[model samples]
Target: MIVSLHSYIAFLALAVVLLAFINALNGFLTGREFQQKRDRSISLAGVAFFHLQFLIGVIVYFVSAKGFYALSEVGIGNLSSEARLLALEHPTTNLIAVALVTIGWSRHKKASSDKAKFKSVALFYGIGLVLILSRIPWSQWV
Candidate 1:
């Protein structure tokens, strides 16, 4: 049940993060004024969802036998490439990606100009999205 919830929420979180990145990119390219309500809300939603995923992931890590237990049993070197991915690479990379998104949110908040805010969100969130995409357990997810 926890894994199912985590998987479902992960999809939503990824979607929102992508939307946030695209919105920021549009704002930057068009030189549009960043509205307090819309832009801020989108960025906040992205950050919030990412944090939620991180929390869910932590829970899943402990609860799922394939997470910590697998790593402990097999040891790092003994793990097959696929097992190592789920037990280590995926979670660690996703965590870092989420951190990047959070940092982007913080930088966007502190930005004085509309362009600066847009740039901050676009660059940081974009990188985060890429990192997350690269490390996701695609086979398991499917």
Candidate 2:
């Protein structure tokens, strides 16, 4: 059940991250004034989604048979590629990715100008998204 919730949350988290990244990229490229309230809200929403997803994923990792149990059964040194991806890479990489998103949102607030704010989101969130996409176990999830 927790795994299922984590899986479902992945879709929403990815969507909001993409939306926030693209929106910031557009604003940065076009030199648009970042609407203080709206822009921050969008970034915050994305950050919130990522934070929630990461926590749920951590919970699922401990509970799911495919997660910690598989890791324990095979041991880290003996894990197969699929098991390694699920038990190690996915969780580790996703955690870092979410951290990046959170940092980006926090840093954007400290930025002095609209361009800086947009750039902060574009760079951090964009890289974070790529990391997330790379680490997801597509074969299992799909």
Alpha carbon lDDT of each predicted model: 0.93, 0.92
- Residues 1-142, candidate 1, lDDT per residue (tens digit)? 9999999999999999999999999999999999989998998899999899889999999899889989999899999999888899989998889889989999998999999999999999999999999988898897
Question: Cα deviation in Å at residue 122, candidate 2?
Answer: 0.8
| Residue pairs in collision within model 1 | none
Model 2 compared with the native: what TM-score?
0.97
TM-score of every candidate? 0.98, 0.97
Regions of candidate 2 where Cα sits further than 4 Å from its true position: none
